[model samples]
Target: MSLRIDVAGLRPERVSVAPSPLAELGMALHALAEPGHHPGLQGWVTAVTAGLDPHLADRMCEADFLWRTTFSDLFLPCAGIPGRTALPGATLADELDLLDKLTDEQFVDCALEFICAPGYDLPSAGVVSDPELRRRAFDLAATRGPRQVRFTRRLLDDPPRVRAWLRQFLRDCDEAFFADVWARVRPPLAADARLKTDLLRRKGLAETLTSVSSAVTLDEEAARITVDKLVVGRSATGDGGLLLVPTSLGWPHLMVLHRYGWQPVLHYPVGSPEPAAPPSVEQLALRMTALSHPVRMRICRMLARSAYTTTELAQVHGVSAPEISRHLTLLKKAGLVTTRRRGRYLLHQLDVAVVARLGSDFLEGILR
Candidate 1:
């Protein structure tokens, strides 16, 4: 059965600050100036600025770019290189070609090598054919467990190479195969209709469509809105459709929705605001207080990698079981970890989604 819900109406009840008017205006000005930053602001700006003077538009665009630079530095400190200015002389097609080249396999490889080298346990290069590679992959996976090594060794023998190979493979595959592969790779995005709805709700139809159209050329905004209005109960919507929005704030925001078939619904949207929820004072206090203790933080990191019983955690941390349990209690109270009873043993695992939201909130507070 298929189901759907309008996300705009389902927004979390706890109100957080909307992006400030100044921020919005600044973003608009940047969109007019650089054109690149406007990816998120695209259709909305076009819709809003329909009758403005051309020269005034140009000035606003420059201001928009400046704000984009400032906001990015503050909010997305780890954002990849900002692309070249897309101005009057540059066409959207040209900017897109540049974006494609920017995030190509070579660049992705470089990024993986840089960011993942410290945490990477498996060997690099042609590990696909080597028995040693398979052994190491299994050992690494077993030691670190499922959460850390989400993909099988066969799928991740050489992380960078595998990702690149898979990208090309998907490009060549038929729709059915693509859908299967996508499900395996991004089950969270696939399973959660709320993620799609929230994105569309936060970024209205026009802007979402403009950004996505720049990349994949499909009209995802319309499809998503249509689905939102059509899908039935929440449970039924689970099978309704699958739409993959862009991964980041660039030209090709790949928007794919599952509308019964394996075909992808692609789009290019200007930008998307991070989906988040505000932490309660108790939650905030817990996270902040927990960070003050190195032992607790280390325990949190271990839990992030995999679930462990109190005894297992104690063994891994080289501490007594009671000590581990005490820390675990604090973590559980903070909503950073969850516990499930497995016979006589209680297994503890990180609450990743909640942790991510909390982390974002904490950072935003610190930065502000």
Candidate 2:
């Protein structure tokens, strides 16, 4: 599947790279809830999880769905216009203030869109007002997973309360760990934005788009940009243009919010690229040792073809879940495997790019 963004009407001014603390905050929660997805942030995730109180941990679990679906979309730029707001440069408080301004209806409406059809064009609020249409949308969202069903029920029952909960939840997260995280990531995010801005100025938009990630490509003649994604979607930039948000936690995946009633957004990874840095001698040795086990090698081979949960792997390999999980921990620490939330389960997959890069990385390290 691929996403095609019609950039025929897009202006150079329409594209800008900027930091988003709210987005980062949401992603931080996501990283915490689904730590296995972000192997690179394992240290940070472990530290945060270990330091968290039960109340905070419970809070994070309740809001985990926000990340799985899309938290950044909920905080769309004011008026859905890209350059009209200072959101690109806004602080967490500033963004939260904007979020606070969301009326109950608007909040629920936005939530419904994401819950129903994530990664597609967001229907305008008016379109969502149709009773039958809204019911069908909610029905579709409900079928997604138990989390979606529960969230939908709560949202439909009392949007204002849910809204308040969301606000407080984010506040709790900020007080707990996100504030420090924002502080640490802000400088790098700013620098990355500036670097991309410079790249845009020196190179053309096509080159800039391609540089965003290997998954992104631009067709100058077609005046379109295509993102290789799991979801198939297509939309035009329209007059609102595109907002390019750079995030430190957005690695391993790319997000495109091509929606109606808002400017399209492309959230790309920044700061350091994948494999962030070359592996150390000890790290390479560990990786090699991880694959030395026949069972672990077979598991890697299976994951290279498709993602599977620990239970599923156990069933297939005729091993107990506990044993599979133990082996997975070793592989995860070795950076040979990574996991992401698929419905209610964590789906583990082989990090093929990392695996392929191992040989070159080892050679480069030795040569250096």
Candidate 3:
């Protein structure tokens, strides 16, 4: 049967309005996929930590990376592919172009479909608005497998149900898988044992874990696995805070904690608000305002990966240097980006940290 899925129904909550669980997941996964220098992910980690016990949050971050890695490896093989064609050796720009062509609505729909479907099922089949596009999506899914087709259909029918299924699905991931993965990761995590010892000395391991556990009812095995995975052979410091690598998967643990009814104490930077305070409506307005200008937003997205010269930005965006400069100036003023002098040229990079904070604040307001 032929189907035409309206990408509109899959609308994700605006990043500037309220944070959707899906957006949280996306941010987390994005962080796990690209470990360092993604300020957007770091901002998320910081926001989540604001409401969590420092030690527990740290552990959750460690565990989250493992989960994220497994999830990515299992699904979304096309993640590395940049564009519509999925060329054999596509450049990052090519992949980004594919991403760029996708409307926010289309991208969210695909993400919902991906999470809802069983492993590696492509939902592109039912999403094509045109007959030709439908055929191509179908062809791609078919080449992958029957499972992909079936899963995509399920995703098209009801995404929330699929998301619920995923929670349970994660609960059921083999205990051994986590155990083995932990064994592989434990050594490096332990390399800085003194920090762990200091954290324990300050708060005590049991108290820290208990405080965090109160917020989320982790399965006994899951909790044990996490402790074993992260704390084994590690020493704590006097302050009871240890620096643990953060990951996208950690957000789920935070969600799970929130679900269990524990209130975490969030710490924000000097200029930011406390996590407990309602997100300012004005912040949301600012983000929406920022996104309202398509050309400017596009410029922001392009600069997100790396800095670009004014001339280079103009060429990539198909605009004049004067126009590009105008937009860049506005972006800089908004604290959305920064520029540096490079060999008589200016380069720009996305102020991801600011974006993350803006995103977190906006979402928190809406969700509340």
* Per-residue C-alpha lDDT of model 3 across residues 78-164, encoded as one tens digit per residue: 222322112211222232343344333344244433333322223233352445644445465566567555544454455445444
Best by TM-score: 2
Report lDDT (Cα) of residue 152, candidate 2.
77
TM-score of candidate 3 versus the correct structure, residues matched by position:
0.25
The TM-scores of all predictions, comma-separated, are: 0.30, 0.69, 0.25
- Candidate 2: list runs displaced more than 4 Å: 69-72, 75-86, 101-106, 113-115, 125-150, 275-368
Give the C-alpha miss distance for residue 357 in model 2, angstroms. 6.4
Q: Candidate 3, overall lDDT?
A: 0.39
By lDDT: ranked, best first: 2, 1, 3
| lDDT tens readout by residue for model 2, 85-200 | 33453787777777767566556666766567532365554423457765776688768777777887787767778888988888888888888999888998889888888999
State which candidate, 1 or 2, has the greater lDDT: 2
Better of 1 and 2 by TM-score: 2
Q: What lDDT does the true structure give each of the candidates?
A: 0.40, 0.74, 0.39
